[model samples]
Target chain A: MAVKYYFYPLWLRFWHWLNAVLCILLILTGLSMQYSNPDFPFMRFDLAVSIHNITGILLTASYLIFLVGNMITGNGRYYHLNLRTISTELMKQFKYYTLGLFRGEKPPFPINEKRKFNPLQKISYAVVMYVFIPLLIITGWALLFPEITIHDVFGVSGLHLTDLLHLIIGFFVSVFLIVHIYFSTIGATPLSHFKAMFNGWHKTHD
Target chain B: MMIKGMRIQALIWMFFFMIANAGLFAQQTDSIPENVKENQKCLKCHGNKYYSYYNDWVEGDVRERMNPFYVIDSAEYYNSNHKTFTCIDCHSYEYEEFPHPGYLRMEPSYSCMDCHGFGDEWAKFNFEEIQSEYEKSIHSQKHNETFSCWMCHNPHEYKISARTEENIKEVIAYDNAICLNCHADIDEFMFIAERENPNVLETHDWLPNQALHFKSVRCIECHAEQSDTLLVAHNILPKEKAVKKCVECHSDNSLLMASLYRYQAKEERNKAGFFNSALLGEYYVVGANRNYYLNLISIVLFGLVVLGIGVHIVLRIINK
Candidate 1:
């Protein structure tokens, strides 16, 4: 028996779980604060705002740390797109999800040290981590200090455009949340993918 | 001798009767009260016609409207901080006599230091230093020609509440009026005129190079109200709140509120066509019908909750 070794790094595990928890909290408090309703008793409006700001700062810091860690550990290379391989892998995964899996077919893409995520996940995470997250942070900072030199960084016209883009990106994140939960259920068993996230390893049944 | 004594007695009786009559006349003259006398004096100068006009106006009203120069809500003004003060309180000793000519009603000035007992502190503070800075402002230059401090701030009523939608519209209108007052071509300054004008590149010597589109935009539209003072400042929302505000406007559907349920199903599709159809349906067909979407969303959310719990249990078993 050839035992394949694929261990999740300690840093990756920490960042993943921290981001997950913070993102959830951010969404909950964000929803509560937005509506200004008394029903969501998790936190008061003022406290929720405080928590959201603090959490946002922490999330930004954590993302920076994650970026540095990824660069140092060479994990960033996994995100590099090879069009042919990606297209092929994505199609296989899609097919498995839609039709093949019902017939008790095995997952076409195997977990390896170099390629942990499916092609779709790779692309999604790449966009999320590299593009959307950074845009959101920059726009958020600009919005925070309207009296400051935000206009210098991006001109007045550009700032307004950036703000609109930021709002669209936020809508995208909400949609991502709904889709992420749905995809989390698509493993061999409904809980398999979730368990893997916690345990740092998936149990492959032969 | 008896005739002379009788004459002296009659003279004494006449003098006593005269003293009693004088007392009765003095009481009658002094009987008119101060208020009545003041009103009569005011009528003398203002004319009986003015008095009648005032009387007709205030007959059914509790407010006393003496001045017609400014539109004053007398009831609200009387209930304010200056309630105890009469018209003459600030304008004391202005009128030397009834119908005094060239008498100017003194403009009420505010001194926070007076009531606050910080007179010494204020005395040392140079108003000229701050006034010089304000004088340099663009707002100050335009304000000089068309309007004064009274245009924006009520001198008597210094404290103002948060800018309401109506007040914001009024402020914008005032800004437009200020622009038109200086600009010779009033049509050039008007929003619709600017849009229609073919000479967009033409530089008018009369008008400033800065665009007047800002005059059309309401103040509160861009500036958010500060949480503490309710005054519109700059962007004051924290990142989380900003994100939340963005979501509140942009989110197609929200599970957090009952109001958002109508769009919940459309939200899940991630299809532009579905959203467009949903929007059309919502506007044209659904109209006020929201219960259908609400019930559907509740069911879906309930299912999600149950699935999450079930997944949690399954994960626990797998770990074991």
Candidate 2:
């Protein structure tokens, strides 16, 4: 039998869509500015800079909303890992991805109404939200207010270090985005997970 | 067919009109003044030859005498920015007699300030402040060391505006050339160098890459007052007062930023004011410049990540 469960909440869905749009815009504009070939202009240099800065600010706000929503609605517990079983569960997920999934084995931990993500999803999402995204925000702010920051580090100025870190982490985010989109299609139906994200109900096999 | 015929007739009429106008414009520009043509004769002797003589001997000692020479190669003079101006515009005195008056040598009155010192255009630039500052500088304080503006700059051959990075660097290199001409010479620089420092390299040891610093940055940027404007400060400080702190030039709002940048757009300047990285387009500083290597690394990383995702997708499909 197939069952319908409320997997994505209204606030989470709104935050997810906003974050998704901003991330995609930021990545496109950021790449356009960095490469900077007039022959292959993605947009005018000034336009790219303006759009990138505005979208970055919006993304920061959306991130805060996500954090607050997670806490206030008690959705934050879904992300909490039992440290003792974390390695064992991580290995099980890893094995499922590498070998077991190829032989038609089921996921080690499945998503439910209470537990929103599989073990793999929980670890990756937590890291992206808590670690990578925060680093990007901190570095972006540092780049914006270079006059007040540490002026130089390791022969390069503080501005350069901030740019370098931002670029490095931005690469990781780009990779995460690609992987996230691909993984979103992994459900009973290709559109089932996407539908769940939009309407808050996911179809699960029992 | 009728519209095409009309277009051809219009094109022919326009071509003939352009030809007639071009001829008229050429005639207008070709009319040089009668006085300017007459002054070309003055270059016959003064422009083609070199003159040298020795003077100021101590007890008639030949080795200790000072040698002075004047040579203005016509080829070089014609190439100068001041080539269009007649000689009398600058040497503003009456000396038309066959034998020039001896009083001309007695007076040292020719000055750029006579024309460029005061006026709406000149006063707006504040060149008078620069002149006053120059007078108060360490170079002016020395009793025996008298230097003129011509010593460092050729009034004839100067670039007022360097629009490109290469041009800006070339202008800086030319200005530094005057200092290097004397400083690189053991006989001229030995006295100054010894009084300043025993070791030239050691004096500038605070700079991480002294060679690169000297190559790109003007000497006055460190040895003069940090100017808010693009012009170099004329009040040259003593060696003791020179800026040595690394942060002054390394920071986001660097002291050298104004003079170091050239031909920047208004937007670029404004962005730089807010401590933005948009101004990094023209030049590179150690920590302040962007690296293309990071972009290459990002591309490779993206490729690897995509490949990993592709494999994951293929396996999922096979399982399904």
TM-score for all predictions?
0.43, 0.50
User: Across residues B19-88, which tens digit of lDDT does each residue of candidate 1 receive?
Assistant: 9989998898698555335433443433222332234455652324345544444445543445444444
lDDT of 2 by residue, B270-318 (tens): 3432242433542344223434555467778888888988888887766
What is each candidate's fraction of native interface contacts (fnat)? 0.00, 0.18
Worst 10 residues of 1 chain B by lDDT: B281-290
Location of the lowest summed lDDT over 10 successive residues in candidate 2 chain A = A33-42
Top-lDDT candidate index: 2
lDDT of model 1, residue A95: 81
Query: Model 2 over residues A1-206: C-alpha lDDT tens digits?
Result: 77798868899899999999999998998776665544445576556667888898898999999999988999889899787888898899889878976887777776667777778888889899999999998887765544555654664456666776887788788888988898788778778888988998989745
- What is the C-alpha lDDT profile of model 1 across A34-108, one tens digit per residue? 334333344565566667667777889889988998899888887888877887888888887555655567668
Model 2 clash count equals 2
Docking verdict class for candidate 2: incorrect
Q: Candidate 2, after superposition: displacement of residue B72 in Å?
A: 28
Clashes of 1: 0
